[model samples]
Every structure is written in structure tokens, then in C-alpha cells.
Target: MNDADNRPVADHPFPRFSDQELARRRRAVHDLMEEAGVGHLLVYGSDRSGSAVPWLSEWPVTREAALVITPNGDDHLLIQHYNHLPNARRVARGVEVDWAGPSTMSRVAQLLPAAADQGIGVIGPLRARDHQLLSESVGELVYLDAQYTRLRLVKSDEEIERLREAARFSDLSVAAIIDQLEPGMTERELAAIVEGSYLAEGATNHIHYFATTPMASPDTCVPAQFQSTRRIEVGDILFCEISAAYWGYAGQILRTFIIGADPTPLFVELHDVADDAYDAILSVIRPGVHARDLVNASAVIEERGFTTYDDLVHGYGGGYLPPVLGSSSRPNLPVPDLHLEQGMALVVQPNVITPDQRAGVQTGQLVVVTGSGADSLHNIDRGLGRIG
Candidate 1:
């Protein structure tokens, strides 16, 4: 079967990882299992969402999939949906691929020796029923989601290169929108432009959210999680949060634009504050910097009588990893007691919103932590975009 990219599903080439990278991931998984003292590891996924399955086995989960790893033997990958078997076999590296049968969890249980009593380490989003079945079958089930996240926190050189490609594709998508934005366009049309920018290039969508409201009487603060049918007017302000993916890796970027006119004073103020917060947050990101420090830098928003409706900054690539932070005025979650490490990717977005949550501007993009500081992976212009 061939996908939209004109690449055969069984032998697609754009997303392959090197054998060395795959082996490095395997070693990390084994080390995690040893530290947790588990005999077997089960990585589960549904609807193509789990990060670990792809990181370890190179198989993007489709429908449902599970990977079973043993310390001394070859790893086994069980893919659900009979039709997906051929592609899973071809794409996945260094793992034995097989059909998962009617019940994926039952197949997993049968793989565990009947006489074995060692605990099993579990990762990914297993359903409650499946959790119960695994618990009954094993002596103990060790939840290793956190450890798995830790394994993904630092990107290898190969992973960073993939992220850079994703970021470039993302920039193209944003530029497409800015170039074609018209006063009478609907939010749906805006989304079409975003996907159109990269779909022919074999990229996929992670997320693309929009908010359109008149600058004179702004009613929406943050970008809506879903697109709208509202017709954009001459003086409307449109802001979007978009991520275009290459394989499973994606780059997230947010920007605001004024349609057919210059921004009003209120809109100008919101974007200026957002730009400052974006700069402040990025200036403090480096190896060994605490998560709290990033939030502290965004205090300019609150100090200037503005606040944020979305996370000021967050870990990105491989999943929403950790250290998700918000401004002091609006705490998304308790600041994690984590420090930055080199090669960690983060989205330093500052969705500076009014105190009443009626207006805002979006600014930021994906960046990688380096020896000196954070480096942006995107080349999109960082300004309040204006369209006519």
C-alpha cells in the first residue's frame, strides 16, 4: 500500500533511523529495566500516539501495537490490525514483528512464561481493562512511564536532525498561511493552507489551532483548540498554534496576524508583551537552568499588567516531555524541580493575554538547548505578521 507521499508503506524511506541510533535506544531501555529490576517490558500504544514504540522499535503505532522486551533475547513487536503487518515488519528495525491476534494483551500474557514470577515493567497508555488483565497475569506490574520519559528527554544527534527537518516544514506551513491570508477567508481556509504547505512533501499534522476575533472587540484570548468557520473580517486578528510533523517528530510554532490592516493599539500592546516574554524566557534557557527560572523571566507579562493563557514554555519533541511552566499570574502546574540539559528541545511560547482573557498574541517556536544557550530550529519571521 502506498501512502499520500507516493512511498510504499512497506518500504518508505524518509523516516528511517540508523542502526546505531536504534541500538542506543535499546541499551537505554535495558538499563532502565535493570534499574527498575523488571524481567520483561511491555510498551503499549493505540491510535498511533505512543512515543516509546517508535523510539525503540521504529514502528509508528497504528490502531494498536505492543512491544515486548527481554534482557537477553531479541525484542518482539506485536502489531494489531492484520493489514498493518507488512509495513511494521519493514519499518521496524532489529525487532521480530508478528500479528497481535484478537486480543493484544492476551498475546502479551502468553509470551510471558507460565512459571516465571518476575515483575513486568509497563509503558504507554494501556487501557484499564488491559491493565487489570496484565496485573492478574504477572506477579507485579511496574509503571515505567516516568523512566521512559526520562530516556526521551535528551535527544541524540540523529533525533535533533529529524527535529530540524520537522521545524523547517513547520516554518513553511506558517509562511504559507501568512502569504495567502485574506480578509474574507474563514478559519477553515486558513487550516487548509497550513496542511497544503507540507502534505505534498510527506509531512503530517500534529496540531493546528486558530482564533479569529476583531481587534476592536476582541472576544477570544488564546487560540482555540479547534478551527472555526467564522469569516475573517478586514480588521480581524488571527492567531494560530501549528505543528507539522516529519515521521513522528514535529515542531510547534505560534504566531498572530492582523488581516487587511495594521494592528490597533491594544493588539500592538499584546504582541509587544508576548514578544518580550518570548525573548525573556529564551534568554534564560541553558544547561543547568531550573524550570522556575524560565517562569521568572516571563514575570514581565504580569508586571506589565498582562498575563498568559497558555504555557509560557514547555518541553517538546518526542512528546510533551516535562518542565511545563506558566507565568506567575497563571500557574498551569506546580513548577517541576528539573534542570535543563543539553540537546533538550523546548517550545518557548508566550501567549500573552489580557487580564480579562479577551485578547492575546502568540509568539515562539521550537528551540534546542546547547552548550551556550537555546538555539531556534525555525526560520519563520518573529514579528506580528500583517496580511492584506
Candidate 2:
């Protein structure tokens, strides 16, 4: 979505999901659970990525959270820490948000029936201890991770608008970096400045401020968060990854900039190849296309004699969901073979690796799938450029 469409900028500490939207999400989950013969369901997650917690409820999990749903359409939350109970009350509206008493499973067991056919379905990664407890309490716990992923893969209209705002915020963050970036500044200093800019613009959370340059050791195509106190040098081809989150939705922009180096043949070729591969995938993206089809279309990198270093493409909003279109050498197995659906958000970057898993240009764009093709979420130049 463009500023011309007049959407709100991504910023805010709390999330935004209207009552109707929330009802729609719950109904979707309920339908899935009922179809799977799940008598009870648990959507487990934490705040690290806000994985399934925010998706399940507007409530952001501080450390741990579980949204429990019964076949009777009753919804509840087993959140941690008694001190955070007030937070639950404020954010987790309508649900029975109760303190899960350090022993989460025990609390979950209390709310659920002790029947062998209860078939408690779980949707996130669980610790062994928690799993054991759940097993004992619920009898048979079913894995529904993929089912949940499928349910969230196609975002709703409201979600698409929020993602658009998030993407716009991230795009603006890149622009902020260009405006503030200068030599003589340490990567850490640059990170702080960039992060602060996004915060001011209303991003409630930050994804990261990572930087890599040709001068740096271990040239991996992957971008690394700036850690060294060493100052950025001249003549170095640098890559930076910036992402910002509004409420819980995330958007990212990855690009490379030349310090003082002349555009080397290697640099230009890698950037151009990655760009072409990006376009190739874009050319085939639309409703009903298989995810692997996009991965297969991105063979230009290998055809041009370059090793890949990162995921050619992955998703966002659900904090990195599946359908990851990977490199040709190690393409991701699109298990279940998910088809491209409208309103799916993804960040595509063909990170070119130079033989030894060491560095190459890592640039990308965030896009939402459309009926005919894909819409670019961020408005930044795709080609590499020199800061000098």
C-alpha cells in the first residue's frame, strides 16, 4: 500500500485487532480444531518472535503464554507470572486469562477434561517436561503446528493493511539510514541511530540493525549484526538488514551500499544475478502457484556460477512462517506443497554466496502476493549503490 492510499504509519506499543477481526481468527481456529477432532486446543508461544501468541490473541506474551480453546467455543489464556495478571486483564479481553501457576501444564489440566479422547492439539514448540505433563493430563497430544501455519499463511484484509503499514515503516527506516549514515561511525553507533529513528516513527519493536562489509572477515552471504567497536572503513562494500515492527507485524529491507569502492565486476554480477532471480520468482508469483515453483524459477544464480548463502525467500507477520523458497543447491522442501495465495507476505532475497559459504551481496524486498503477480511493499532502489 502507498502513502497515497493514506494508511496509518506503523507505530504503537499495543497491537490492533478489531473485535470482528478477532472473532474471525477465533472462528478459523475453532473450525480447524473441530475438523481435526480435537476436543481441546492449545496455541503455545512466547514473545521472542511473538510467534503464535499475538496471532492467537492480541495479548503479547512476555515470557510464555497459551491460548486454550474448548470444543464448546470457550476461549481462555494460561499466562505466566502473577505480577503480569493485570497485563492479561487489560490485553487479553474476553478470555479467561489466569495465572498458570509456574506449572503451566497442571493449570492447563485443571481447565481441561480428563478424558482419553480429549485429543489436546498443540501448535508450537514445547519443552519435554511440559510435553510430558500435557501427555499425562490430556492422554494424547496432537501436533498441529502445520495446521496453524496453514491457517495463518493467508492473512485477512485487516492484517494485510497492518502489514502494509509495517512494511512502509521498514522502508522509511532504510531511508533514515541513508540520511544518517556516514564513515567514521562504528557499526554499533549506526545501529543505535537507526533503531532510535524507527522508535520515534512509532515502531513498538525492532527486528535488528545488522551490517557486513567486504573488509570484514568470513565473507558469508548472510548479514550479521554489527558487533565490533571497529569503525566502518572506506572502499568497503557493505550490506545492511533493517526491520521494524508495528504492534506485532514485521517488515524488513535488506540492501548493499559501497563505501568508496568502485563498483567491482564481482559485486555488480552478484547483485544483478540476485536481482534477476528475485524478478524471476516475482514473474511466476500469483494465486495457485506452488511455492517450489518460485524456488525453481530462482536458478539463475547457480546458472551464473554462484553459490547461495541464505533463504531465497521466507515469510513474515507470523514471525517467519513456512514456504521458505531456498537456494537451488539446497532448496527448501515445500512440504504439503503450499500454493501461493493472495495476501501472503514474504521477504525475498537471493543471498549469493562466494563458494565457501563466505560473503556475497545480500539484498531483498518485502512483497504481498496479488491476483496477477506480487506487489512490492517497500519503495527502495533494488540495485546496489555507492555512498560516496
Best candidate according to TM-score: 1
Alpha-carbon RMSD, each predicted model: 3.2, 4.8
Can you list the residue pairs that collide in candidate 2? 11-202, 219-358, 219-359, 220-358, 220-359
**Reference-based lDDT, each prediction:** 0.87, 0.75
Per-residue CA lDDT of model 2 for 135-225, tens digit only, reads 8776888888878878878888888888878888887767776777788888787777666776776785456546556544535566775
Query: Once superposed on the true structure, which residue ranges of model 1 sit more than 4 Å away at CA?
Result: 1-12, 114-116
Alpha-carbon deviation at 68 in model 2, angstroms:
1.6
Per-residue C-alpha lDDT of model 1 across residues 271-356, encoded as one tens digit per residue = 99889888988888899999999999988898889988888888988999798988899997999999999999999999988889
Question: What's the CA error at residue 135 for candidate 2, in Å?
Answer: 1.8
